[model samples]
Target: MEQEANKKRKIIHIDMDAFYASVEQRDHPEYRGKPVIVGGSPNSRGVVATASYEARKFGVRSAMSSRRAVQLCPDGIFVYPRFDVYKDVSRHIREIFSRYTDLIEPLSLDEAYLDVSVDKQGIGSAIEIARLIKQAIKDELRLTASAGVSINKFVAKIASDMNKPDGLTFIGPSQITGFMEQLPVEKFHGVGKVTAEKMKKMGLHTGADLKRLSENEIKQYFGKPGAFYYRIVRGIDEREVQPHRETKSAGAEDTFPVDLTEIETLNKELERIGALVATRLKRHNLKGRTITLKIKYSDFKQITRNQSLPFATDDLEVIVKTAQQLLAAVDHEEKAIRLLGISLSNFGEVIAIHGNSTQLSLFD
Candidate 1:
């Protein structure tokens, strides 16, 4: 019965093509077919949010520094993001998705996962449902979307990116094994540049190579995530599409313009990062019992240290003090630090004390 249900599971991953840039082009006829870069000013310390296909041709990409984007594509038309407009568009797309299935999990404003195993529209085929959703978006919103249909989320997400703007690809159970085997290790979701380099060093360059390692051997080398890799390579992703998934964590990180070796400078940086996390916690009305400090060395090696407090807190002083304590335990003196980040997690209902008076918990 379990095997039958797994076989019957139908998932679809939808992603908008260069969402922000594409929206800009769609609204402005003059910008169509031209490079569009949506982000901060090139003169300031900002990064690219999204780049149009035309800008991508010049090697400009999201998360890249605006200064570098300009150097790569000098003629690129840079524009600030209009998040309000994007959110409105996202709501409209969600409305279209509701016509098919309510089991929709939004990954971001421009991407989502839909479990159309039993679509409300009475569609028996997931592929057909995906086509209808895409057609609806194009017809109603005048926007193009790419889709990937498969039996599981992992396969579906990978398949969706196989094609570009206005593309739809499906991976059936029979095709999953071969499709994953030929995929590069770097192409696997959650495998970053650092992990990919480590995988390559271990002679694991493709999904096939990863599948050869036993679960125990993979875990021994890569820890918990290794077990995940072992199963995913064999097309075993049992994770569900959660529509109302809670925010597991919220944090901020910044890559420095230059690596800092001085303890004083590192401490100052941590103070700023801690304050940012605290501000966000207050904004979201969240309190967390665990505080995590993340550090990346000049060589790109990263480490995270976490400390759990007796009670959840959103206090700036508490966050800063906890982060400082965690930083003290790390051997930062041995290496130059290129990045610093602080995050709070392990959230639950707890008494929130404000100005010496207890207030209602946000979770309540």
Candidate 2:
């Protein structure tokens, strides 16, 4: 029954290619076929949010420093982000998803997971639904989106990235295991650069290599995420497409032009960030019991410290004082602080479901 249920579940992952850069290119015809980068200025201590395919050819990538991006793609065009416009476009894209299924889980403005086991249009084939959706975005939004169709979210997400702009990939149930076995450990969703390197150092380079370890052994090595690696190696992912994923936290941060070592400077910056967090919480009418402070050193090593208050708060004074206290406790006498952030979480509220709720198929 479990195997049958897994086989019957139809999942699709949709990801827009270079969403921010693509949108800029679509709106500005002159940017077509050119290296367009959307983010802070190259001269600033800002990072690249997105880079066009042309820019990527020069090795410029998202999250890379804008200064490095400029060095890589000297002729790249830099444009500030237009989030409002992107959000509007995202709404249109979600509307397109709604035409086929209401079981849509938006991972971000540029990507989403869709459950079409029982599509609204009664289009039984998940592959066909993906193709049509891709075509619709191209025709109506003048943008390209890649899609992947499979039995579950994990495989579907990996498949979606396998193809490039305007591509669609369909991985059937029978192909899942073989595909996973051959996959590099680095390709797993939660495995970051450090984890991948550690895995490779341990002679575990692929899913097949990981499969050689017992679940307990993997857990002992990788901690909590090891159990996930164990199951995903065999293509066993039963996670659902949740339409109303909760907003885990709200926060803001800033990257400094020059790293600072002074306690006074750090305290002032934390005050500013705390005020921003307070404003955001009040804007959304949210009060969180836990306050977290993220610190990034000059060498790019990062750490986080959090304190849970006896009560939830959205007050600027409370937020600022708490963040300052957290910063005060960190022993950073020699380390230069390059970035500081504050966020509030643990909202004591029921998670609300979005969309027009629909009945799941018998398979679900």
Per-model TM-score, in order, reads 0.79, 0.77
Identify the candidate with maximal TM-score.
1
How far in Å is the alpha carbon of 276 misplaced in model 1? 13
What tens digits encode model 2's per-residue C-alpha lDDT throughout 1-364? 5556778899999999999899999999999999999876887644566789999999998766677889999999999766557777888999999999999998777899999999999989999999999999999999999999999999999999998878899999899888998999999998977689899999999999999999999999999999999988888888989999887798888788799998888887776566556544533446788999999999988999999999876666677788889888888859999889999999977222122021000001
- Model 1 per-residue lDDT tens digits across residues 153-228: 9999998898898999999988988988989999999787767888999999999999889999999988889988
The pairs that clash in candidate 2 are none
By summed lDDT, the worst window of 10 consecutive residues in model 2 runs over: 355-364
**Stretches of candidate 1 above 4 Å error?**
1-4, 251-292, 296-340, 344-364
Off by over 4 Å in 2: 250-291, 294-304, 307-325, 331-364
| lDDT to native, each model | 0.82, 0.84
Q: Alpha carbon lDDT of residue 333, candidate 2?
A: 54
